[model samples]
Target: MAPHHPEDVGMTAAEQPRQGGKGPRRAVAARDRTRQPTEVRRRLIVDAAVPLIAERGYKSVGVRDVAAAAGVSVGTVTYHFDSVQEVLSEAMVLHIEQYYAALSEAAEHATSGAEALRLLVDALFTEDTDRHWRMWFDFWHAGEQSTDETFARGQADRYTAWHRQIRALAERGVADGEFSGDDLDGFTARFAALADGLALQRLRQAPPLTTQQARHHLNRLIERELVPRSPA
Candidate 1:
């Protein structure tokens, strides 16, 4: 039989108690759901899950926790998502979108594409961004461990988009006569690869690649290939 609503999925034991006929939980749920649109409410759950997952990680976050985080009911979380994994997935997608939006904002505010690239590098390698980095690493690790091919494929798709964004920055640099276009493809791949590698190294912490050092290395790449004249 088709589910009557998005909430019709079989409730787990954890969810059952909260939804039992008439109680504070049910009353609280009623108050929370008053005239809330499905998509808007679902967004609330996902947004709440993002910070929790960022701080607590995927294994630690649960539907109950998300409900508490969102000031909604546990049933509301299950109403929006069929599984904890699905909730986390949606949260990660939001996280990535916000991360990229930050990068774009940093880049867009600059006067030149070279400045944009520099701003992007600076924005990326910051102490404030460590939480973002941790979340991404967690997502990547989940993708690596999952047997589903879509996990890997989705990661690759995100990577491709990241590369394209970097390349677009370089294209702007070239158009402004600030960078050479001779090896744009090669430079894009190298820059993206180096960023990932350096991030992992910094996170690894044995050899201790500082954020400053990472920024310096990325800036040097820009200076070497993209600068119009000798790096100042």
Candidate 2:
């Protein structure tokens, strides 16, 4: 057979081999794809740990338990996170990010300030009741002694984001002839406090308040403040 030139072998101009060249670059790309599963497994481990730490508190949970919850090996969990503290820190960041993202989405879709407030309150309280509340309490306890900057920063960011959203909604209500509050800051602070208090109440009380009761109470509070009243 005649000798085949690089071009005759279907190599493109860019694919032409240089002097002393190594093998194809595609091999490196393929290797990266293979490693992606490890990255995905790491994320799974973190996701699994969020609920576990939320339910059991971070100190009570161990690396092996997270690995087991994630259905991965302990080495895999450690490969992604150095320790339980690291895992919990990362998990808190992820949870806060996701929680805020949902709130943002809800606000974007809401038709009015009242609707936005409703969505915000619902997001704060809506969950699988027992499991969600348990996890939240766990996180509270875990965070008490946590000196992790990332965890603290994430929490502060969440609070700031929430305040901004509530303030924006209050402003929108004023602009749309809905709300007549004199102090946006005071109202927003009160609203947030009410929601947090309600969440804790439901979390601690046996046979926790039904979703309807929770919604009714929140809606009434929001309506009284944000809804337009009929002229007498």
Best by lDDT: 1
TM-scores for all candidates? 0.81, 0.71
Model 1: per-residue Cα lDDT at residue 215: 97
Report how far off residue 153 is in candidate 1 (Å): 4.0
Cα lDDT tens digits for candidate 2, 79-178: 6676777887677667767866877798879898767777877776666544555655566666677787777776677678878888898888777677
User: Candidate 1 at 168: error in angstroms?
Assistant: 0.5
| Candidate 2 residue-wise lDDT at 105 | 91
**Taking the tens digit of each residue's C-alpha lDDT, what string does model 1 give over 60-176?**
888889888887667767777778778887788888888998899888888998899989999888888888888888988888787867567877878888998999999998888
Q: In model 2, which runs have C-alpha deviations exceeding 4 angstroms?
A: 1-33, 37-41, 127-130, 206-208, 227-232
**How large is the C-alpha RMSD of every model relative to the true structure?**
5.0, 11.1
